[model samples]
Target: MKRQPKGTRIRLLLAAFAAATPVAYGFFWSEVRGRGTPDGSSIEVRVPEGATSLEVAGVLAAEGFIFRPRVFDAYVRLKGQGRQLKAGRYEIPRGASYSYLLKVLQTGSVVTTPLTIPEGLRVPQVAERLAAYVGDSTATVLAWLTDPKRIGELGVPGPTIEGYLFPETYRFAEGVGIPVIVRAMVGRYKAFWGTEERARAAALGLDEREIVTLASIVEKEVRWGEERPVVAGVYWNRLERDMLLQADPTVQYALGEPRARLLYRGIDSVADHPYNTYTQPGLPPGPIASPGAASLHAALHPADHDYIFFVARNDGSHEFSRTLREHNNARNRIRLARESAER
Candidate 1:
């Protein structure tokens, strides 16, 4: 082929450069445009505890909050972000670029407010904790719980949002919406109920809602993890025989009080309440607390025994019995143990 003239070659080079410029700019600008402008819009990003960099990238991509999560991975690789990524809430620019978002998450830049919902706490108590932490009124939290719109938004498969909110430590950003937190907690509950648990519940002829209700009862009965299955078995036996659960937790739930001790009057009051297992047969209307995985598992696969009663032992364990006579003896044993310890 004949060599081109110098000027023509130079012109050709310029044309090639011009052609490539738009493609390069388009790629770069697409990333930029997808990202939220840092001018005024801020977003809260959560880097889950013990999450991998790829998991974080997936979350960011799914949220549409970051542009190019691959860029997040690359940034983490270069900046050692993977090692430094902290589990907490982070405030970031809405539509932040993946690199910037990763950096923010890596540095724990999300403002964190601690919310602790203790085990066995009722919905009201959990609402109060969230209210105190979020600086929102407890009424606002309560309203959110009862708001059918909000509950629907969370996709909680029930009429009310009660018993769906998982109890655990949650770190929320300053501007994180309450609905978002509630949905996240509910999602946690669903996730915690793995396929195995679902299958077990199905085998037991129980649905998710019923399992949760039973789990809540088991949770109340089980002060110690070891005793959970035992208590669960007792409840299951009672349920099979058409006996009242006669659970004090249900009575306490009906009374809306912390059940350190049970009152005979309360159980015998006969005032109609859905949660009073003494008055009502079968599971309560809903869960009383967010049952952990253990409780849920126990609810589905109760211990193989004919136990119909259990009494709390002094060391947070329980004594199980098959019959009322056996249960009475166990109860007396526990009472004697308590008295001896008191002395």
Candidate 2:
């Protein structure tokens, strides 16, 4: 038997270690960090544009989608794929290993689902849209929005979450929770209301929530930004004069059901509901809809006008009048215009 030199044996062992390192990494990555699952099931993980490597790792780890972020980092750094990880959205498997996650990101397998939440939707309507977007039940969203405890948990200083949910288009991955979506919208609303609006609302003897309530009525009443101030003025005038606002939106809210059209008889008959401005003689108990910035500003600083009645013209504008006679005339003209347009 020939004895190998000590130096030669050491060199051979070093070479073997070098060769085994990558294989060990691959196997460990599969077992602990998620390399490959036999089922090939995929999941979606968003790495948002402009996220740092650390941020990407933290998000994945926090979401429990990845078991070993360091392994992912190391592999990406070695492969020079760290810089190749594009932002936007990605679909990853539930038990995806770190290596698989890195590969998915490097290959730009991000998925983005467009979420369009229209303007002027109430909580229930918005919830319905959200559920449809995530393929969840609308009731799930309502359960969160309507939960007073949930509102408190969000740190919103309000009794309800009605006026705080800002309406806008969102890009959400599939299977997001209702609370997460609501929190995102509420956070946007908080940012919007954080500036001069809060102070202004306080000075006007209105709380932030009350201002939102009034803004909501203005939102439903006025279609044009320029008209919002005037519409707000009319409601303020009614509040000052001790006259019933008799806003259609308030009556609609009182009805507790959504309808495309409202009848005079319905307004006259809907009784004892707090949101009926015609009966309550002031702003409704809460917001009628989630108002935008323009409506909110208009509510805070209404135009100086005594005009009490506004009828929607055939065009997307309103006919403002100071007296019942004038209001009736405008209404008649609107009716005539509608008749003409139908013909």
Stretches of candidate 1 off by over 4 Å are: 1-114
Q: List model 1 lDDT by residue over 1-343, tens digit each.
A: 9998756764575467558897754564466445555577666667788888877877777767756777556546545457677777666666676556666776677686767766666678778978877789999888778777865677765546766788778777766777778777888887877888777778899888888888888887787787788788888888889998998888887887775778788777645887888888888878887777788778887888877877778887777777889989888888998899899
- lDDT of model number 1: 0.75
- Worst lDDT run of 10 residues, candidate 1, spans 28-37
For model 2 the TM-score comes to 0.70
In model 1, the Cα lDDT at residue 83 comes to 67
Candidate 2 off by > 4 Å: 1-111
Residue range 280-313, candidate 2, lDDT tens digits: 7677777888888788889999999889889887
**74, model 1: CA deviation in Å?**
23
TM-scores of the models, in the given order?
0.67, 0.70
Which candidate tops TM-score?
A: 2
Sliding window of 10 residues with minimal summed lDDT for model 2? 29-38
RMSD of candidate 1 to the truth, in angstroms, is 11.5
The prediction achieving the highest lDDT against the true structure is: 2
